[model samples]
Target: MAELNINGNRRMLIGKVVSDKADKTIVVLVETLVKHPLYKKYIRRRTKFMAHDPANDCKIGDKVQIVEFRPLSRRKRWHLDKILEKAV
Candidate 1:
């Protein structure tokens, strides 16, 4: 038998950290696309995710990578993985 890795199927996203508050919660903005039904064109969309910041090192406008995890709070289901770029 093989062990099922449920938690290991985490999702990773690259975005910018928009906010850090409430002790260890951070907000990340991820930009993606949505296909237009009629025109068949892709539209850009921005999504905000509330994630757990265990180390609390992220800041506003800082590019970061986040991964999906078990809910840390009522809203937080993602965790900070690493900072890809710093805010200027």
Candidate 2:
């Protein structure tokens, strides 16, 4: 059998920190657009994700990047990778 080459699995998301609560968990809000099939009108949608911030460096209104990792808690399956940009 040939050895299988497994690629590392990670997820990256750019969003704004909606909340920073718990010990090291922050909520990120990701906005996206969906277009109607017939009308082609775009609709705005938002999703919230719980990400782990070990350093507690993220704050509300700050834009950041998050990556997937081993589950840190019941809802935290992602961790803060970096702060891409800060909110003005």
Q: Evaluated with TM-score, which candidate comes out highest?
A: 1
TM-score to native of every candidate shown: 0.84, 0.82
Q: What is the C-alpha RMSD of each candidate to the true structure, in Å?
A: 6.6, 7.8
| Candidate 2 local lDDT, residue 42 | 88
Which residue pairs in candidate 2 have backbone atoms (N, alpha carbon, C) closer than 3 angstroms, thus clashing? Answer: none
lDDT of 2: 0.80
What does candidate 1's lDDT look like per residue over 6-82, in tens digits? 44587788888878867888899888877999999988888888988878888899998888889777888988888
Positional deviation of 54 in candidate 2, in angstroms?
Answer: 0.3
Assess the local accuracy of residue 8 in candidate 1 as a C-alpha lDDT between 0 and 100: 59
| Number of clashes found in candidate 2 | 0
